[model samples]
Each structure stands twice: as C-alpha cells, then as structure tokens.
Target chain A: DAGVTQSPTHLIKTRGQQVTLRCSPKSGHDTVSWYQQALGQGPQFIFQYYEEEERQRGNFPDRFSGHQFPNYSSELNVNALLLGDSALYLCASKINGGYEQYFGPGTRLTVT
Target chain B: AQSVAQPEDQVNVAEGNPLTVKCTYSVSGNPYLFWYVQYPNRGLQFLLKYITGDNLVKGSYGFEAEFNKSQTSFHLKKPSALVSDSALYFCAVPRAGSYQLTFGKGTKLSVIP
Candidate 1:
C-alpha cells in the first residue's frame, strides 16, 4: 500500500498569507497527524485527527488548524504565516492506538 | 507532558565502525519510544519502536535500540555503520495517555568511507 501522500511537494508564500496543505493517509489507516520540521531539527507535533475530528494538539498557535475528511484524508491550514513557519510539513498515518506511524515525503513551505 | 532529548547535534564515524545515537525521554507514565531516520529532503521514516518487553529492539537497515527504563533512555545503535546510514536521526516518545509524540531536536550522522 502507498504510504501517506502530501500535496504540493513545495510551496512559497509571503508573510501574512494563508496556505493549506493536504495529506492522504496510508490505506486502512484511520488516524492522521501533522508535524513541522525546521531545518536541522526533528519534527514538532502540530495536531492529530481521527474520525473527522481533531483528537489532540501540540503547542502550536491557533493560526494553525487542521481537518480530517470522512475518507481519512487530512489538511493542515496555517494563517498569518511568519518566516519561522518556513519548514517541512509532514503527515503521518497510523491506526487508532497504534504506536508505529508511516510518514509522507512532506511539503516544504518557504515564507518569503 | 512528554519530551525527548537527543544530546548530540552530529555524530561522525568511519564506515564499518559501530555507531550510537543517544536519546533520553521524560513522561508521566510508561512511555512508547521510537526512532526515525530522515534522508535529505525527505520526511521522517520509522526505524523502530519500543512498546514493552525486550529492551533490545532491532529494526530496518540493521539498526537497533535498547530501552533502559531506569535511565529513561532509548539509544539507537548500529553494529556496523555504512555511508548510506548518514542522515538525520530523531528520537520520539508517545505519551502514555495521549496520541501525540514529542520529538527531540535530531542528530545528524555522517559516516565517512
């Protein structure tokens, strides 16, 4: 089965602009989580979605939000972007309560 | 709150040499630990996980990690390093009562031939 897939392998936006990133979880996976990875850093948790609702979230600001579709696909929305938001956005998929997670290639966002 | 720590920013070793990437974690209850590798321009890849039992966990690409509860550590190791193993390594911990995973800053491994 294909692993998690993310749209717009790369993106560029200006400060204060809004952007939406998409993700399709691996087949048979019901949970989706998003992370942001800055250069030279491990990924930081953004949020997690399960059953079309956000299950948990991290320390990210309210400017960051997400949605999960009935089909288990997910989208991450970031508004009022800042230069610090420029990083690799990753999508991870797994079954509910499962510990192992599969990841996508990620969307590299650059705020100019 | 759960958190992970990768002490080394970068680890350097020659090919065929053993390599170890140190990691420590803190959580309220039993923790689920994991190791992931990221190649240039790619997202994190799951290398292995420690749920319970068996402190020594082996994973893909001949990688292994030992879970030490007393020390609150889960360090990744490779019996023999390879040039291909040179990449970014991440240590993650899944909170016992939550689904979120707290990650470390990451360690860049460079293996010279």
Candidate 2:
C-alpha cells in the first residue's frame, strides 16, 4: 500500500510570487491536513480538508488556502509569498475517524 | 484552546539506557495526545497516540508513553535506547472537535553508542 505522497521535493520562489504544493493521501485515507515547519521549529497546522471542504484552519493568513479533490488528493496554495514563507510544507492523511495520521516526505518551499 | 510543551530542547542517553522525553499539555476538554519522530530533512513520523483507555500506550519501535491526567503530561519512554533512535521527537494535541494538531517545539534525542 502506498503512503502519503507529496510533489516537488524542493522549490524556490521570489517575493510576491505564488506556489502550489500537491499531496496524495495515503491509501484508504480520506482526511488531509497541511502543516508548515519553519527552521528549528515544530510544524504548525495550516488547515484540514474533508469531503472537499475545509473543516478547520489554523492562525494563518488568507494568503494560504487549500483544496481537496474527490480522490482525497489535496493541494496547498500560497500567494504573495514572503521570505518568512520559506519552510517545509508537510502533508498528512488519516481515516475520517482515526487518531493516527500518516505523513508524507514534505515539500521544501524556499522563498528567496 | 489546546497546546503541548516539550520542556527539553535535547536529551542525551547512552545506548542500552532507558530514555525519557518529557511532554506536558494544556487543553479545555479531554486531551488527544500524540508522539511523532522525525529524522533529518524528513517529515514527522507517527509514534503513538493516547485518546482513551489505558494510560500507558505502547507504540512502534518499542516506544511507549504514560498519560498522567493529574499532571497533564504524556512523556515518551523506551526501555532501551538505540542509536538509530537519535532524532527529533514531537508531542502534539488536537483541539476539541478538530483535526488540526498543535505540535510542541520538538525535542531532539541523542543516543551515544
């Protein structure tokens, strides 16, 4: 069985640019969540998607948004990126009612 | 609001020694606690979770955690440390009725051979 997978192992962007990160949920999983891990810090929740709708969001700006497709794959979009936006973006997936989540390798976003 | 705290930034233990990584949490309702480990340049890997039932929960890699309601703490412990276990450990909690996991600043474990 395939685990959670993410695209673009690494990325580089300039200020005011936009970037999109993709994630494929683990097999037999339905819920997808996104997190941002800055240098030397634990991951901070970005948002979660279930049933193609955003269920819960963290204390992030409007510039951060996400979408979940029917197949349970998800995408994270960040607009007007700033240097601070540079971090590792991780994708995790779990069953609708399950407590344990499986994580992807993550996409490294470097805003230059 | 819910939060987790990993008091120590790093822990050092010799091989074959018992290892402990401390964690404390704050939540409005019953806590859903979790532990994850991350290696260099990798995403967080699920270690274990404490939702309900037994206070002592066993998980992968011979790791376990004890949930103490009185102290609001869940510390990860392993009977014998392995050099491969040297990595970053994170404690997390989910808010009531939410899937968002609030992670504590990770604690790095170093096991010397």
Candidate 3:
C-alpha cells in the first residue's frame, strides 16, 4: 500500500551542472511519468517509461532523459542545467492502461 | 493539438460556501479529461477523471465535475468550501494517440475562514 516515493528531496546545482532525481513507483504500479513544475505554474510533461523502455516523451529537449528499472523505479537526469531548470520534478505511476496516476512528493531542483 | 485552459489564476471563497473552479479543454473525439490538485511544495494528486458516460463525475473529497460537451468544458465543483481545501488545481487532457498529457496553467483556490 505504499505510495510513490522520490529521493533527493531537495537539490542545488550551478548552471551547466548535472542533476539526477529518483522515484519509486507505488507498489504494483508499472508505468512511470515525469513532469517539471515551475513556481506558480502547472506541471509540464517530461517523459514516460514502461517496461524499462521510454514509451513517450514531451517537447522537452534531449538534455532531459529518464530510465525505468525493472523494479518499476525510475530516474530523471538533466544535463547542462540552466536556471530555468529549477523547479519541482514530479514522478507519477499507475497500472498499465489505467487512467488514474498517483504521484510522489517530488524533488525540488534549484539551479543557481 | 490537445489543450486545457483554466481561465482563473486565483479564486477566493468564504468558508462553508460553495465554490467552482472553471476548466476548459479542446481535443478531438471523446476527450479523456482529469483533475489534479497540488498542495504547497508537493506533487500533483489525482482528483478525478472523465473518460466516458455520466457527464457528472464524482471524485475524492466531496468534489465533483460537470462535463459540458457543447462548450468543451469540465468545471470542478464542491458544495462546501473547506479551509483545508485551499490549494492549486489543474485540469489535464491526454494527447490523442500519445501517452503524455496537456495540463492547464492551474487555478489557486483560497478559502477564507
């Protein structure tokens, strides 16, 4: 009955640096999606992973990437981070083909 | 392109009063819409969704939404406002044939006690 969990609750990085965020899907959930939420704005889709392969991605550039482990956990990696990359990174999971997704607390990334 | 719009940037309501947060979406064919809420410094939580049947859908926390086909809108409603209910709400619609979702900018609800 565990909900989605994320690691590195808070992060600080300088411009051009790299950062990685981690997430563990809810128990029994198989699909994981990533999103970036800027202050005072809704989340923007990043990419999604299923069956250890990326299934779909948003309009974000290649600098943003992700991976899903066989255990249903996932990681979001950002390279050459910019100040605009500072935001809350959220990870959500749901059963395959399920419409409802449960989310984690999210990792806050701060780029200076 | 699929899109969702929350016309209101912020909404204020008196405690115990009913409240409505408007959301509108444009997409092809039958739309699969969803409502999500986010608290301060937290991730978005699923509130409800409308896939098919019953234009009026009830969701968690005594919240419900009405789907208006003619207007291409889905408005979130709650009979009574709670101070605890004050949070950011987002309306989202998945891209057709795509696994990603398009979300509204979000509406911030503030309930005055």
* Candidate 2 C-alpha lDDT tens digits along B72-111: 9999999999999999999999866777788999999999
Question: In model 1, which regions exceed 4 Å deviation?
Answer: none
Record all residue pairs in model 3 with backbone atoms less than 3 Å apart, i.e. clashing. Answer: none
lDDT of 2: 0.95
> In model 1, what lDDT does residue A35 have?
94
Docking class of 3: medium
> What C-alpha lDDT, on a 0 to 100 scale, does residue A30 get in candidate 1?
98
Query: What is the DockQ for all candidates, taken in turn?
Result: 0.82, 0.78, 0.76
Worst 10 residues of 3 chain A by lDDT: A94-103
The residue-level lDDT of candidate 2 at A11 comes to 99
TM-score, per-candidate, Cα-based:
0.96, 0.97, 0.98
Off by over 4 Å in 2: none
Worst 10 residues of 2 chain A by lDDT: A96-105
Candidate 2 clashes between residue pairs 3 or more apart in a chain or in different chains: none
Maximum-TM-score candidate: 3
Q: Compared with the true structure, what per-residue lDDT tens digits does model 3 show for residues A24-77?
A: 999999999999999988889899999999998988999999999989999999
Residue-level lDDT of model 1, residues A1-112, one tens digit each, is 7888999999999999999999999999999999998887778889999999998988899999999999999999999999999999999999998888899999999999
- Residue pairs clashing, model 1: none
Ranking by lDDT: 2, 3, 1
lDDT of candidate 3 over B1-113, digit per residue (tens): 99999999999999999999999999988899999999888888889999999999999999999999999999999999999999999999998887577889999999999
